[model samples]
Each structure stands twice: as structure tokens, then as C-alpha cells.
Target: MILQSLVRLYDELSRQGKVAREGWGTAKVSHRLVLDEAGNLTGIVSARKKVLRGKKEKEIPSDMMVPLMVIRTTGVKANFLCDNSGYFLGVDKKGKPERTKECFEAARVLHHQILDGCHGAEAKAILSYFDRWHVDTARECPLIQENLEDILDGSNFLIQVGNRDATEIPEIRKAWDDYFKSAGEEGNEERGQCLITGKKDEPIAILHPKIKGVQGAQSSGANLVSFNKDKISFCSYGYDGEQGKNAPVSKEAANAYGTALNFLLADRTHAKVMGDTTVVYWSEHAKTVCQDCFLGMMGDDSGLTDKELDDILIHMKNGQSADVSGVTVSPDEPFYILGLAPNGARISVRFFLRNTFGTFIKNIAAHEERLKIVHPPWEKDWIPLWSVVKATANPHSKDSASSPLLAGSLLKAVFLDGRYPEALFQNILRRIFSDHDEPAGGGKPEMFKVSYVKAAMIKAYLLKNCGTKWEGKIQMAVNENCNDISYVLGRLFSVLENIQQSANPDINSTIKDRYFNSACATPAAVFPVLWKLANAHLGKLDQPRAVYFKKKLGLLMDKIAMPDRGTPLPHRLTLDEQGAFVLGYYQETQARYAGKKEDK
Candidate 1:
């Protein structure tokens, strides 16, 4: 019956184009079949094509492929499958193949062993023993020992018995439902709510609502009200006993008083919203005070009693203060209170105002600019160094040869920093120098001389200090610099390569003779070599030692050669006029010495 089922499944697979070539050759492919003690088939396993070797004469029954398909078809996470090769079989933590031929052959033997008995509960129990043993062997398979635990625990199994009446099993459904509902709840709670506004909505500003209350008795007092979003406006004009019994104050003072009142109202309203009660103490000549004796207060919430208010007022009155009005309250109204000064005392009221819209806007803009300046995420996507260099070299723009060099240097400092991959570095160099339309001229030679001098200096520094570890990186730097020079020259100059190889002899030897002759014969060539040596030496020394060598080299070069003029001189000679003059003197002396030796 098991063989019949296997044949039927293979036939269906062939009809669906899932199995290759429908004839006898198809069954010849090895299929990894998983079975229980009852000889019931559990799964089929296959291998992917990449792992398969030899001419594609016939596709193997892929153990890996079969399980992937089974997963899609059955919606189960408890099946096991493995390739036919012992090297790729699945196993349990104990390291044994779960579906070995020995286990299958034994189960087949047991199937016959149990067939003689009556097809009752006792026969089923005997068959179940074979199934359990098959699972145990897979868990302990030696071929997949390392991954045995994963196979046993990680893989899923599915039982698709047609007309088996599994619906009658209440325990299984309840267990499955409980597991899924717990998982669903966990997923939902992981996403939390917004904390600031206590709402799962977009960000919004918090505004304080104003309150209404009884107006004070002063004639100059006026009601305060919100005129627009985030703003409060009011007017104030009151009696001054000093001028006469009911003399009104100046319009300017009233307007100023009105403005002050608006600010005071906003402040008190905000304080109340923040759960702080306020007390207002009014003096004709003193600054405004809150209910808690908070004079010129901001953000303070400590409460004050009537006795404290009395003491504060007494102190103000002793300082020649006039009439005072005191009220203890929360920020409940848009009304203002005015105090009249008896006879000739001065009168003034002061209050805090909400920050202006323009001020807040300016603050926000400044903050945004600061954020952009500090964390510039856009810089990561900058064009490649070669592209930037080539663009800067175009004659159409106000670009020069030096522009590209500077641009390349900037790019090195900003992006590469010696960490970029080798392929990327090569790609950058190729892009920069691949297109060259200009004719090779004196400018080309001049640019080569300058670039070569700089490249040699860099090479010397790397070799003298970094040793073998620096070899690959230095070569890349040299190649990149050479590409840049090649673009400038409008043709390949093998001379730079020769100089580099001579400096590090293990490298390719193209222009070794030319480099040697130039170093021996010309001050221009020798200067770069010497400068590179000195600079490399200086870099490896202490600060004081570096300064000493730098000064000595400066003096030595000054006495040897004259500086190049009408163009930018080499970096070594450009350091100082004394150095160039010294180098010039040395060059002539060396030439005379060489001529004398030849004559001899």
C-alpha cells in the first residue's frame, strides 16, 4: 500500500512538470522518503542544482527542494528532509540519520511482522514503535550531527491522512488556537502609542485655555481676551489720585499697560494649565506680583499665604510705595486689575508676555540649520572621486590641472581614507583617465614632474614606515595618482611607473633607467626624491626631532639649487627661497664634478 502511494504521488508530480522526464529514468533519481514505524510516508527530500555536480544528464530528486514544496502545499512547520548523499542528510541532536536505509528496511520487515496479527489496537501500537524509532534515528544521524539539533527542533512535520476525522480531536484545536492568539497579542502590543500628546496622532503644540473672572475696581483696568491663535490683547486706562480724583493716565502709558497686561494674562494662563495657582499683588508704583508673592516670577510654583503677602507689601510700602491691591486666585479670567496711587505717587504695572511668533520662527530655523550642519547625511552619496576630478579638469569651466588634483585630495580626505575596496579604487582611477583628447605638450611633462614628485614622496613615506603591510595600499595610491597624471599628459607616461618601481624594486620595472638618470643628473628630479625621504623621516620622529630635520633639510636644499620660476616650483623647493638657492648651488657643483670624472 505504501509503494502504491509513492507511485501515485510520483505520477502526479510528473504530470505537473515538477518531475523531469516522465519515463523510467525519472524513478531512477534518488528520492529521500521519510516514514514512520507504521511504514506511512512522512516527507520527500531533494537537493538544489548548485550543489549537484557532473553533466546535467538527469536532475537528482532534491531533498532540499521537496521540503520547500511540501511547506508551501501543507502549511506545516514540522517536517524533515535531506539529500541522498550522506554528507547532506538531516539528523537529530544525538547524530543519526532520521531516515536511513537500515531504519526503512527494518520498518518494512516490521510491516510484514505486524501484518499477520489482527488489524487492531495492539497491531497499531507495534507499528507506532517503528515510527518512533525512525524519528529517533533521524534525530541522531551522524552525517548531519552538527545540525542534528536544528533539524529535530527547527523543521516541521505534517500528517495529511484523508478522511481521518481529525475534527473529532478537541485537544489539538484548542492547543493550536491558544498558541496563535498569544502570538497575535504579543505582536500587537510591541507597537506602542505616542507619549507627548497622549494620542496616536501627528505632533501638535499644546495651548493653554484662558479663564474668566470678576474685574478689579480700578478705573484703568480692562478685560483681556484672545484675539487670535496663540495671542492675547487688552487695553488699560485708570484713575490717578495724584493729578486729581479721577484723572486718566496718558494714552501711551495705557497702550504700554495694555501690552503688559496681555503678556501677564498669557503667563498666568500657562501657569494654571501647568497646575500652578497664581496670586496678583498690585501697587501703583511697583512691578506686578502673583498671588504667591511671586514678583517678576517665571516657572515657580511654591504657594504663599496671606501673611507672606502682607509682609511683602509692608516691605514695598516702607520703601515709599503707594496704594496696593492684592488678590489671591488661579488664572481664571481675561479681566485686569488696576490700583490707584493716592495723591502724588507714581503708578506702573509690569507683566511677562508670551514669546512672539517671529522669535519662535527664527529659533526653529536656527535649530534646523544647526542640525544640518552637524549631521550632514547627504555627503555619503557624493559623486566618486574620479568623477569630481574629471569634472574639475574640463577646460570649459574655470578649472585647471591643479583643480583636479586638489579635488582628488579632498575626495581622499573625505571618502576613501584608505578604507575603500580595491575594486572601487581601480574603478575610480579608470574613470578619471580613460578619456584623453588633448595633445601631449610641455604642460604634460610639467604636470607629470609635479605629480611624480608628490607620488614619490607618498611612496617613500609608506615604504619606510609601513613595510610589507602597506604594500597593497601604496600601490593603489600610486596607480590612482598615475591615472590622474595620465589624464593630464593626454598619453601614458611609463616614466612615473619606473620611478615608483625603483623606489620599491619588487614592483614592475618599466622606466628604471630613465628614473635613475633623472635622479642623478637634475636638481629638479633629485629634489623630489630627497624631499620625500626627509618628509618620511620627519613623520616618524618626535616633534622636536622632526622640527630639527625639517630645518636642516631647508638649509641644505637652499644652498644646492635655484628655484624654478614662471611656473609653480616643486613642493620641496617651494618650501623656502634659501632652500631653492642652496639646491641650485648643489646642482651646478654636482654637474661640474661629474664632467671632471668623465674627462679623467
Candidate 2:
């Protein structure tokens, strides 16, 4: 029987394209077969190698042609007959033929049993069973035909059952049927009483099915069903009005729709759908209803439409910005809401205000959970130089000014002279002096000069505060006249005297003579008196020295004839033609001091 099976397998392989045209050599057959004594085959096997001198040459040693015939026979016997026929199919121990009638009879009996049991089973189930049996038989067999080995390696088939054309399984179809049946029954139970008018002979049911399957099952119309308990029954389909029976929305429905729209607009996480009625579609992962949708259902339309909602939702799905403009009362204000899709983009509803009453076009910033109820007004004002200076010193200040250092320099110039770059000075002055009570004419210049003088006085006071240490430098310089300190002090005092003589007309010539003679004749004589006065003031320096300097300087100023108190100092001095007077005096005093030092 084994020999017969082997011969049948060889013929089957030749019929198939799996085997080479030239028969396998003796060596190949030997590799595939192992046998027992008494000329009875006991095992089969397969191997492959390069055919050194064949038409089909160079290839992977394992790429042997499949033994299709041998595989089919083995599969049939093991899978259908349920018996081991692989042991009796090849060369014997002594390389002779092995055959037996008894073995064939046993295989025939097993085949009959399988055929009877498996005849009516589904082809898929039968194939599955056969596949299992084939695998078991192959593993148990000690040796297999070369083609059989190839066939086993090549076959990796799967089987499917039932009608291939069916769109849904039986279970799903049954579920749909059950759901629709239950829905229908519920609709019938909730049906309202028929409305009867006086002119009508018989009452008519307000809502009746218009057409069965008029719209396909997948369409919105087919998916809709309505029920009512009131005398005036209402019916409509398509939640968004894209499809289904068209019906006018009653006041109640409108309110409901408006409420839904508000809720959808308010929801931060759910992309809003605005239509006649707002809707928030739920996803598997995002199961919560949108707060905006809930608010909309409660009747709020902050200026949104169903189409806009749909557009925003579409954008949300695509991971794009879903901001829609012109929906709210203030069009410039943005209304931020959540994106519907899993994409983390936000949907914004914007309102543009038309012809607002303020100088600036107002824009209110809003988002989900936070709405700007009142928009603050914007005002324009100049920023002070001091503010700029302070801001520059503090790194934490976020001032919008471009260059704080430049601002500070400009401010300092104005503080020192009250006449800096006109534009910057005026701007900073306006900010600082806006609240001052001083008049704007001559009073303004006077006030500005006073401010400048006050700054200088503060510097002098600070130096005086240095006490004996500060006086020692001046005393030493005066005694030794080191580095021409005597000449410098004489020059400075002469400049002050000249200014006083020009400004005041009541000065005594004797006092002027004494000041000049002491300042220039012997710088030491001027230094002792000036030093004693400065030290005395420094000893009592807790008092306001700035005020003291202003008062004392005013008392000493010569009374020069002037038009009014408000006249600018520059204008007065120019009118008097004292341009070179102070400078000439300073030069002469320095020259006198220098000559006297040379003589000493």
C-alpha cells in the first residue's frame, strides 16, 4: 500500500507545476526515504541541493520544486482516512520496493468512516478539520517525499464560510430589527388624539407616516420618527434640517433650538454646531456633551448660525482654526469654544461692533468660561521722564519706551538747564508740570529756572554734607593754590558777581569792589570767609539748604530794571546786551589771580 501511495504521489506531482520536469535522482530519493527489513517501507523524507548539471541550475538549495502529488495523497489519507499511511511509501532498508495489501485495506476503512461523518458539514468546517489533521500527520512522519515537503511549506491557505455578498451578519441584522420594532411600538403608544374641526366630518390624525422608505435608511429622513401627547402634534426629521420632512419650528421648538445653540457656543471642549437648533455631536472618547450646546438648548444665540457651527466642526475635525466672525454683538470680541474632534484646536465666535461710540474701536477679548462684560476705555497721555528713568533702573519694569537711557539723558538736560531738545523737554515737562498751579507765560520760564537752580542747590548741599573731608580738599588747594585752584575759585565767584550785577541795579559799588578785590587779590582771603560760612551751614545742614541758597542768592542779586517778574532770564539778559560781560569778568579775575600767584 505504501509503495502504491508513493507511486500515486509521484504522478500527482508531475501533473502539478510544483515539481521539476526531470525526475529526482537516486541520491535525492535516498535523502527522502528510510525503510525497515522484509522489503517493507517504514519512513519517508525530503531534502534539496543544487542540480550541478541540470537545465534548471543555480538557486537557493531549499528552493526545491514542491511535490504536489505526494502532498495531496498524504493529505487525503491523513485528513480523510484518519490513518497513518506515510510509513509505507518509499525505498526499503535494502533499497527495494515495499508494498502490502493489508495496509491498503486498513486505510480504506478509515476513509469510509470520515466520509460518512463529514459529508454534510460546511466546506469551511471540513477544511479546518483537514488542516489540523494534515499538520499532525506531517509532524509525526519521520521522513517525507521531497515534493510533499515543498507542498507543506508552500500551502498557507485559509477558509471562509457563508454568503460572501452579505453586508451584515445575522446577529447585527437581528439587532436592527429589534430596535426598529421597539421604536415603532413606542411611537404608536405615544400617538396623540385626532384633531377634529367643526367643519370636518371625521377627526384626522395630526401625524401620519407620509411615505415608507421614501428616503433611504441611511438618510436623515428614514432615521427619523416622531411622537406627541398634545392636541397640536408636531413632526419633523433631520435634526439639522439637511434632509427629512420640512416643518416649521413652533415657538417652543425655536426656544429649544436657541437654548441648544447657546449651550454649544458656551462649551469649551465640544465643537459647536449651529443651525436652526444647535447640536453637539458626541464621540466615543469625548462622551460629555458640550457646555455651549447645553446653553444653546437653554435659548441663547449670541449671534451664531447652524451653518457656521457646521463649518467650525469641520475645521475642528481637520485640525484647523475654527474661528467664525460676525456672530456676537461686538464683532471684534472673540468667543472661544472647544474643538469637537480630538484635535486640540479651539473654535472662536467673533462679533464685530459697528459704529461704536468711543474714539478707539473697542475690542473685547472673550473665551469659553470667561466673557468680558465691560470693555475698558483706552486713553492717550504722555509718560514722564522720571517714570522712564525709574523704569530703566528696575529691570522688572515692562515700559514700552524704546530707550530708557536716552530718555533719562534728555530728562537730566532739562533738569540742569530747563532748555533741552525742545520736543523732548516739552513732552517730559508736560507730564511732570501738568498739575502745577504756576502761570504759563513768564511764570513758566521762572518756574523752570527755579527748578534748575534747585537741582544745583541739592548738589551743593550733598557736597557740603561731606563735612570736614570735603572742606579739607578745598583748604589745601587754596593754601598751596595747587593745580590753579585759586584761579578756578576766583573765576567762579566773578561769574556769580557778574550775573548778580547784571540782574540787580541796587548793588553798592563798594560791596562789588570788596567781592572782586578779595576774590582776586588774595584767593586765600576769599576762601577763609567762604569756608567758615559753608561749614557753619553744613553744621546745621538738617535744614533745607536748597531753600536757603535760593533766598540768599535772591537777597544778593543786584536790582536790574526789568519789565515784569514773568520775563524769561535769557530775554532779559539779551535785551541788556550782557552776552560777553560775565565771561569777560571771569577772564580778568583769573588773570589777576594768576599774576598774584606768580609774584608770590
Q: Please identify model 2 stretches exceeding 4 Å from their true place.
A: 1-175, 178-188, 192-600
TM-scores for the candidates: 0.17, 0.14
Model 1 RMSD, rounded to 1 decimal: 35.8
Q: Rate the local accuracy (lDDT) of all candidates.
A: 0.30, 0.29
Q: Summarize candidate 2's per-residue lDDT along 1-600 as a digit string, tens digits.
A: 211222233333334432232212111122222222221223333334455567667422232232112234422232121122332222122222223233333333433343333332332232333323332244344444534545343222111123221112233223323433343343333222212112222222224222111111222221112333233334334323311123322222222222333333344334322211112322111213222322332224424465654564444434454444632222122222211111112112121111221101111100110111111123112122233332222222364332422442332232222223333322332232222213357433212211221222222221233234333322211222212233244334543443344334465542234444334344444545654444444444335643554444343232222347653122222201121222223344444456557889
| Model 1 Cα lDDT, one tens digit per residue, 131-247 | 444443554444345444434443322222222211112333233334333433432222222221233322211211222221221233333211122211222134221121122
Name the best candidate (by TM-score).
1
Q: What TM value does model 2 have?
A: 0.14
